[model samples]
Target: MLKVFLVEDEYIIRESIKKTINWAAEGFSLVGEAGDGERAYPMILKSEPDIVITDIRMPFMDGLELARLIRVKLPQSRVIILSGHDEFDYAREAIQIGVTEYLLKPISGATLLTAIHGVAQKIRADQSRIDYRAIYEKEHAEKLQLERTDFFKNLVDGKLSMSQVLEQGQHFGMDLSAVWYQVMLFQVRGRDLAEAVRPEAAEADRQALEIEDTIMDLVAVQGHAEMYEQIGDTLCFLLMAQTREELQQTETSLIAKMKKAAEGSDKLLYFIGIGQAVSRLHEIKMAYQSASRAFSARFFSDCSGIFRDTDAGFLPESDQTELDLSRLNMDKLDRRIVYNFLAGGTVTDVPDFVRNYLTGLGRDNLNSLLLRQYVILDSIFAMAAFLKKQGISAAQLEQFQNQFRNFNANLTLDQAETRLCQCFDNALALRDSQSQQQYGRLIEQAKGYIDTHYACEDISLSTVAASVHFSPNHFSSIFGQQTGLSFIEYLTQVRMAKARELLYCTKLKSAEIAFQVGYRDPHYFCYVFKKTHNLTPMEFRSQRGAKAAVTGGTDACG
Candidate 1:
């Protein structure tokens, strides 16, 4: 119902108006009545009525003053001016005050009701427009965000010319005219890092996503930087400033805010890398490249923190100038590093893992042909052994070995790094591929178990998941991903399918069919059958029977 407030100095007139109209029956509510504008203002503020009807002359304040105050504070409230004065100035003043209606004294309730209804219609229309715009902006914002992210990616990858970048930037409301810009990359780690050893780490990925969203919110509220997802698990921030010093300040504040956000979740660890500030728009690629190099340090570093491009390699230039065999602790160059990384690491971890593994072998010592050969051979042996344990085909292992047969000591560090990254990338890819195949087989096993036992009313997700040797949570996630249905949903579908088959081919009552399909309650089965097929069990059978008769075919159940 539309709310209406009445302000009139005459007590008898106010009472007469209130009693004359059954407000509720007319789809209006007389929320409050005030004798003057002074009292009406506060009452109006409280009720927030859709319409305010006030007389022009009052004891303390007039209707025009009340309408003016309401127009400022409660602008959505429509004002109807009831006046005894018929002068043009009074009507003009009411119109100037933005009054919805101006009526002379001795007005009937019917006129007031019509004016109130008109204002109510306008109010509802305004509200509907506001709601529609809200929905439209939300959907459009999501699409625009995706487009903007793509533009940012192309901007950094040097795929777009400076003119194109600036034009598109302006179209997106981003001013790309800054003098200095820097790229920063940050990654949030949750239980995902531990998932290799603990496959049953429930909700780990979900927690990491929540943490990433929170960190993104922090960056968004900063108003000094633009952030977007660069790739899986890594978020990129492009900070622009008028000067390099300002850029540095923004980077520091951004890192601090991000760290603070991550601090809220004990399960989350974050690493941030800030690149060199560049002046030209085209130089953004260089900045991003540098930031990515620094970001890779996350795989090599001992703990979560910040890093820069300067922190890439081990040993200073002075230390690398001499062959320091005495300082080269053979224990530091453990082949277990390769074994552990291959077991737990992903393809993205290849570059940094290779760099760090080589760095640990002593850069100066690696210059010796014998030590270089030893390091390369040791890494290959470890890789091949790990793959063998994973059941890689003998032929594929031979191919892997033959591919690295040319890895000689004469290769430069750059060449060696490239070769090692390729080797590890292939090994990790093969490992993941085999793991997927194994999961496919496991899902098939689980499905077979479900198909056999679905008739048991006591069967459940835990029981079925256990039959296939999987944790309930992990099984639930994989089941949905593989079959596009939850465990319960799939089970229900199997039961319903069987129920339909029995109903069509067997002369069984509905209750017996329900029991045979694992449903204990006949009424619940009927309800579910109707909800799923949009017809009751009896209705469906009758319809099918009628079709059979029309075709001159006998029902098997009949």
Candidate 2:
């Protein structure tokens, strides 16, 4: 309540004004009433009322003099002078003495109340400015600034629990009890190289502050939002809202005004990424992370437009936007790509596999740039295993490790994916080159054994591989690469060639030829013969005999 003191020489006027007006109802309290300014000054000094009302023509001392004294003693207090028509000059001098208002007498009680109410408002405004000035000054102190910056950064990083937040927020001058919050990440973009460098960095910082002030001005109009902190180039905001819709309305207005203000400078382009509303203060960190990635996505989206966590698909699929690793299907994503490549699958599907990973995370609204990187890193073992199977040397493995170690040097999604794909490509290329060198000779030796042993009924991949002192599995792999056929397929072709030769040259019985050509079963031989040439072995022989007879010539063999 505004405290008001009355100083008037006429007892009837002072008593009438005091009795007729409801001072409390008019937002003021009557501290004391005096018969003259001389006696009132002492009472005014004791009460130190926020507002004063005085008659210009008073006994002993006058209103103008009292107003002047009040100005020096308590500048925050407001003075209202009541004067007669003849005292206009005195009222003028009283105004010069810093009186808030000068009203002529026989002033109505309503008019007098209006004068007091107006003075009370100015007095309160003066005090409010002092309070705010002190707050800002204390917050700007270097020690407090550092502590506040670290506390807010850690809170957003999920390094602080709710209890810790409550404990530390008080010291930082934050009312963390406002549990409901929404966050926004604003990134000033498209800065030229010159502006980004040292010579213009100060200007850039100044412009950033101006932009902050403009945004704050818009927020002040709405009266619900507050500036949180600036996280590097991004300005973070923590808005206290009672409902999701209220938060959205506040954000929409803030962004529109900000965009218009930014249009004043083409170089001042910016984008805003808004997070979903959270119910508790501790959840602000999750909201901030969501907004940060949403802002990053603006590069591929509307670069200068406001994007929400939902709009950018930067929050989890559920209403719960909190970060949790369990919700990520990274294992499923890993399987889609060839984590274990040498176990024999092509990585031609890599790009699509990565696309799926991106889609899944976006759909779930997971802020996953770092998560994607970790997925790539976690597959280091797969690359090592592929290298070991290919017989990559210790030196080669070290060289490959160097590339993977530096893979995260740049963590943007595209840059990181490119690095990961390059690693896979290099490793696969090396594996192929190594396989040709290590298995090429053993494969040739195995082929030579198969050619000689075509008539041996027990000839098999294992038997031939043992003759060349190679494991069946190892020899099979080598044979496939060198001959474009498996060990079993190459052996079958060799036996078939020998069977066809016997049928044409010796006029041999089908069963006898089949037995000599590594087939213990004549029926199986006839089936293989017919399938290979579209005719049984006997039919092949008869057709050739007829052709020889028709030509009136002896068989070519004879």
Count clashing residue pairs per candidate.
0, 2
Query: What's the C-alpha lDDT at position 239 in model 2?
Result: 73
Instruction: Give the alpha carbon lDDT tens digit for every residue of 1-558 in model 2.
Output: 778888888888988999989888877789998988788888999999988888888778888888888899888788888888655567668767888898887889888877777777676666656644553353245335445656877888789988898889878656666646888876564343212335655455456556665665676565566454442345567777677777777777777777776656555557787777788876887787666655544433322577766643323334444456666654445431343233322244244334444565554433355565555676565677657655789898888877778655447555655666776677766776685775676676777787878888667666786786543434454566587775656777888888878887995799899889876557667877887889988888889889988998876567
Q: Local error of candidate 2 at 323, Å?
A: 35
What residue runs in model 2 are displaced by over 4 Å at the alpha carbon? 1-142, 170-173, 177-180, 193-206, 217-222, 300-303, 311-558
CA lDDT for candidate 1: 0.77
User: Model 2 misses residue 428 by how many Å?
Assistant: 28
> What TM-score, computed on C-alpha atoms, does each candidate reach?
0.64, 0.36
Alpha-carbon lDDT of model 2: 0.67
**CA RMSD of all predictions:** 12.1, 42.6
Cα deviation in Å at residue 136, candidate 1?
3.0
What local lDDT score does residue 330 receive in model 1, on the 0 to 100 scale? 71
lDDT tens per residue, model 1, 1-558: 889999999999999889988899988898999999998889899999989989989978888888899999998889989888889998998889899899888888788777777888787767756654653464355446656877987988889998998999998888888899899988766523523345444445445556676777787677658877754457789899998788878888988887776665555567888787889999999888778767765655435689888754665423344457786877656555576567556685677667766777677776666676677778788889878877788998998889888766587666767877888887887777777787789999998998898878678776887786554445665676678776766777888888888878877889898888876556667866887899988888888878997998876656
